[model samples]
Target: RSLAESLDAELLMYLAQRRITPGFLNEIDLFLRGHPELAEYTPDFVRRFNNARPLAAYRFFLKGYTRPARYVPGILPERDDQITLPHELPSVASTVDDELVDFFDGYEYRYDILRRIDDQVRALCNFLRSGGRLTWTQRLLVGLTLFGNPVDAYKHYEYNYQTEWLPHRYLPEHVVLSEVPKEPDYSVPTARVRTLDGADDKTRHTFLNTRRKMARANDAGV
Candidate 1:
């Protein structure tokens, strides 16, 4: 039972990531609440079970109620119009140091900071409508990091249809039938041509005549 409950919670987490509706969350919540023995194994349910609002409880579960890190004033570099003296320095003869600095600064100054902030904001607004928290640009960047792009993700999953559902036995009978192609009948009658070889001319001619007569008789049901 403990293992089953743990598995159920894991599945619920996957569904939450897919952004299932509040009603579905409520149903799961009710199910957990009804099964007190199983509820003990699902800490997420216990944490949010007492909340008056089902949606709030669901969001808390989805986001893990994670508190964002306190904003540190100087921890993040200030983005300003003023260029620093080091940035203005001419490239050295080796060029390696300057290239390394540029690469480090590009990731440190932009990608890393933005990624952290994006994660925090996503956690904070776990319940926000589709377009609420992250802007299109932020979504594109994060999506690229995670799944490359929607088109690639779609194509990848579409090519491996089995990944989207449970195994064959668990699927509905009709759904399984719809997906599977009917097997061809290999026993159906087909025309055959026979060659009479390694025989004298008369024997070969006699065999050919006999074959023709048998074919005609069979066709006429005689």
Candidate 2:
């Protein structure tokens, strides 16, 4: 294979193993511009990384740029408990790919997404409850935090749908989920999951403070 092909393969591999952030996407954007066809190799990429990455997480990068990732039609459910993947994808995808990915036959990718969000929400809430602040990494993942809401699901769906992607991605699932997920977990499953749902005074104070701050930041259109 050519250098472009080799680099493309490696890039997808690393991305599947790790998550991406908005700031880091500036780097990936440079990559995508140089290799605009990078999106074309997704089938093979997915085949290899299926056990290493969340389907929605990887799709966030392939949207618009790849033909396989067509707009999903109303798959979100009424509850935030699980993401109901469509029984099938748009057939137009087979024509666009250099190879077809038959891996996503059903809900194989569902658990990890909820697990990913659950993790982020836990991390954010933990920091708040402990009177601790969001780490640099946590701040970078602000988009993935704040779960238990219908809106969070909506944004996550849009982010995964196509190439008009968001930058708050790319951290390895292990880091995002805290611990590594065991076998058959996320495939990229994380380690020990932790949450800070304390009723302590300090926890309450910090939680309110951060919540208001987040509200204001959202109002400021962050």
Best model per lDDT: 2
Model 1 alpha-carbon drift over 4 Å, by segment? 1-27, 30-38, 41-47, 65-222
State the C-alpha lDDT per candidate: 0.34, 0.35
TM-scores for all candidates: the values are 0.19, 0.25
What tens-digit string does per-residue lDDT give for candidate 2 at 1-222?
122233345444544333322233344345445543333544444344334433343343443231112112222222332322233312221222211122233325333444454455455555555665554434323322321122233234334321223322322321212232334643422122234653334333345665664455445443
On a 0 to 100 scale, what is the lDDT of residue 50 in model 2? 39
Best by TM-score: 2
Error of 1 at 72 (Å): 37
Cα lDDT, model 2, residue 26: 44
Across residues 130-186, which tens digit of lDDT does each residue of candidate 1 receive?
334454433323332232322212222222222222232133212212333334863
In candidate 2, which residue ranges exceed 4 Å CA deviation?
1-30, 36-61, 64-107, 147-222
lDDT of 2 at 135: 47
